[model samples]
Target: MAAAAPPHTDHKLGTPILDQPQLQAGGGTAAVTEKARTLDHISDNFSKYLKSAYDDVNKRYDLTTKEGLAKWLVTEQQASQDDVQFFKDGSFDDFIRYYMSGSASVMRPPPPLDDTYPISNYFISSSHNTYLTGNQLSSESSVDAYKNASVLLRGCRCVEVDVWDGEPPSSSSSEDEDETAAPKPKKEKKEKLGLRKRLELRFGRKGSPPPEDQSKPAAASSNQSPDQGADMRIEPWRSNVSTRAEPRVLHGYTLTKDITFRAVCATIRDYAFVTSDLPLIVSLEVHTCPEQQEIMVEIMREYWRGMLVDLPLDSSQNSEEIALPILRDLRKKILVKVKRAHKHPGAADAKPSTLQAPSGEPQRSSSVVSTSTSSSEELPDGTKKPPAPKAKISEALAKLGIYTGGYSFKSLDQPEAKIPTHIFSLSENTLMEVHETQPAALFKHNKHFFMRAYPKGLRLKSSNLNPSRFWRAGVQIVALNWQRWDGGMMQNEAMFAGTAGWVLKPEGYRSTSDEATQKTAIAHHNLDLSIEFLAGQDIPMPPEEDDPKDFKPYVKVELHVEKHEERNAQPIPGGGKSKGGEFKQKTETYRSQNPNFGGEIIKFEGIQGVTEELTFVRYVLSALSSSFSNCNR
Candidate 1:
């Protein structure tokens, strides 16, 4: 027809354009072209492509048809008219590239802050030995540690300060020289002793004679105060040999250096609320004398001013009956957590002092007190000796423990454990023991009161414990060594990602009803997850490597669930098997800088856990021939 209009050809290629509409017997050229275009668009299958690219995009956007997708593209992604048409007409490569190139976030947005709950019903980010930058045994201490934790890290609500008696500024003598000046024979004799012998020598043993230098009386005994004259035996591990009487912060019983308490307080005051306005908890480990303790109180009062929480007056209300204040009530306040001393027989009747709040009416105070004492020493003949006397807490420092009163954790059945304002501190080992043996009780107790778990004393290298284990048991504060950025700290950062370091415990954990407990007991769920490894673009060569052509990249995916003995011990009522372990999968290696995985899907089925909220998925992109690996959570 018109010479069968020479089959439409591309001039540049000099080839027949197969995509052009074919001539039909009864249809006009325009109509044929339009029909062929519509059929081609249908053949391209944009819907299927979009679904594969984003598995849940349609469900998330409430999209049913192409029109809805077009609207979403225009409104949410700010697509141009031409781009919208292109997307609708089956051009998905550009869209996938945009999404995979970090143009859109793959993670769910952080939930809004919910501060209406009781302070006990949240997991607070905390740091252990906040002043130490290296190992627990020997490290340089600095106030900058506090600033890093508070401002740079942004959301550390609890910090530990070990306050010891500081040396006077005018003191010229150095303990290092004195120790070095000791007879070489004495040093050799000390080193020859066994562990038990050394311990017996450090503490006063029943049969062992005291060291000659320590046995001698002090020159200033007549003028020394009672606190200064007390038998404060020097532990062999302590490197701080200062005899001055100012309050300083350091790791007790270790070679860690010291930072002035005033500098610490000032640093904390200046940076505490810079990142978050939530209440800050200072876990005061008081190793100072009463005089220095008073100096600490004065420095805190001067630096914190109106921000420090005042001690509540003695009240008729039972501490066990009162509940902890909500987050709203403690905003912008600094709460000192120290072991409260037992009050004198009739100290409740004493007149108000500057320590008490200005209000004349009585206010409730926590009934918790520390019951822990120094460990008993072993005799030379292996007989057990009585425990050393417990160190006395200064009254001034004890009174500074306003809202949170520190208590030595014994057992969940203890009477003090029921007090709302009482906070129990447990070492990582003890925490693990309790979690494995009594998870239900620990979870229930944490719902009403606060509990903190710190790294055990044996973590001399500053390694961190797995915080997720304690978190699963509903521990409110799992203090970690912030200096190490290992898996534990990465998990911590993820837990507090979108909040001000305080994440509300799950509803089942926070609820106190019997039904809620039952719900939490069997909260396990089975999940089926499929991750599609599509393609890679412009992958960089490994550092220090010579050629990009030698790169062979692959991705390994892992699904990790924090497993606990408690959850496995009690299975769900429906006879479901415990599925609490790790799942790993990997993709085939590709030999190019821009590797195309070609839609290889990795499927994880029957992945189960006590709670899905604690599950984590990790992806590691690694090279087959190289040691380069990039990890993402």
Candidate 2:
């Protein structure tokens, strides 16, 4: 029997677990053998069975030579009956199954529950198996917070406000302020002199000032001021100075200001984890002088593609496969991902060596078109030209429960293909194309697009554990754009992007109430949450004794849970005149003995995913503003 393993924390996730995944030891003779065996588990085969199936397929489909499969990767042409495919890393077969990417992101399973993001700060994933932290769930959550902040500022409408004094108009100089305030006897003389002086300074005038009559003293200015009978109502007018001249108005004007980045981040941080059904569309505001916003958006799109689309081709260094430099050169064109848009001919001018012909002949054609989009050529009906039809295998190369494709792809007996198995073209069936392979852009349903530059798809066993609604209490967040979802940006459908955060449920949540009875009880493994990060005082210490260095930068999230589902708080443990071991039996008990208590200890640990990135969108009245009894806004 295997020895019981000691309790250990998963290094990747920091979660406490009892599993010892058998990792291959490092290189040496023994380690090499172990590694070989491990590779067998992932991919091991001389592939005699697959080769036989391939022969049968060739005979049935009337294929005459190896040229019929020159386009296939080495592993693809010889996969076994049960071989799995995904991410272009697998065999050429349309009906393949099994995920190729290991798991979403590089994160380890969650640490003990107590070490997680504060439940207050992180919403429970629908399955309650993992979490998302950073920005709020919906783009609306951030938007609403921003609107609230703006409205509050409007309400305060402080008696005084600060606005930057613009670079003085070309005709004005900083030195003119002193010149104008020098107390000229005639008010007009002061204005005229300063305006002229500033203009002369800017133009680099070479002349000296006009001779002046004795400038009046302050007492002399009072008499020259508006006469009692004259019209004292001085209308604010265009100054008498020339159009090129300017007057510096330091104290009055309509002052406009921007929402700060820090405030934006705070607003978003405060509400990102509230559980709610509100729409979560995100608009990444790339405010570039207002005029360049559109260009900025384009740049962002290109950046995502450039970073993610090339990851896989960059790794396709093995000897037996056709080279795809175009696939590697992701800077080709930025196309919206809809329909067959992800497909663009790699390059028309480049050597066609990248795309292999089924005949093993290098495609030396002068023109080769990709099958992803409609042709650029226009037709009489105003319809764009359609793509060239790709060649396909006319018959299933597989037969009953084998690499031959005649039988249901899944099992010999579970069920027949619910429908025909030829929905894909022959090439589509043969090569397992990895969808989430590059952290490339996933999809942009509404205004927000989902992205991943790391890890892969995550498995969610159930969606019903979702919290019914999200509550936004204390976040100041930012959103660059906002619009009603035309196609619809539902909260639950938001992808976990590194830049944007989400707080929503999963789709069509399925209940994990119980599995179909298997006769033998099976234990489902959960990503465990460790409770060890709770070693410090539950509440913070008073300020004076607190040293600056001890301040932790993150918001410490704690899980407050019911003890044994309400056992009337372990009756005062100390000083009851009770002997040390008097309650030994009760103390050692796993469940509460109080007649009031019921149910078992929670068997599943709460798991969470942290927001690996964050940014300030805007700031507003934190929902926590009410908690301090009117201390500060």
**Candidate 1 C-alpha lDDT tens digits along 1-633:** 010112232111111112331211010111132232232121123335555755565555544456766676667766544444344333355445344332233444347768898888888888888887666655678886676422223467888887766655654567777677756448778888755555445433321234777643455545545664333332211223254445778865444678899889998998787657788889887755444555676678779988998544334334334456778888889989888643345655555344434454222221223335435434443544445334446555566766688776678887567556788888866776776567667777877788988876656656677676677777888888765544455566557654566777777777444422323543677778898876765565544445777788888776656443346434223222221125688899998777778789999987766365665565656674332222223
lDDT of 2 by residue, 404-450 (tens): 01221222112221111111111111111211121111111000111
Best by lDDT: 1
Per-candidate TM-scores read 0.65, 0.18
The backbone clash count of each candidate, in order, is 0, 54
How much lDDT does candidate 2 score?
A: 0.20
TM-score of 1: 0.65
Runs in model 2 deviating more than 4 A are: 1-282, 286-290, 308-468, 471-540, 546-633
Off by over 4 Å in 1: 1-103, 149-152, 171-244, 312-322, 342-355, 358-390, 515-522, 534-556, 562-564, 568-581, 586-600, 620-633
Determine the C-alpha RMSD for candidate 1 after optimal superposition of all C-alphas. Answer: 17.1
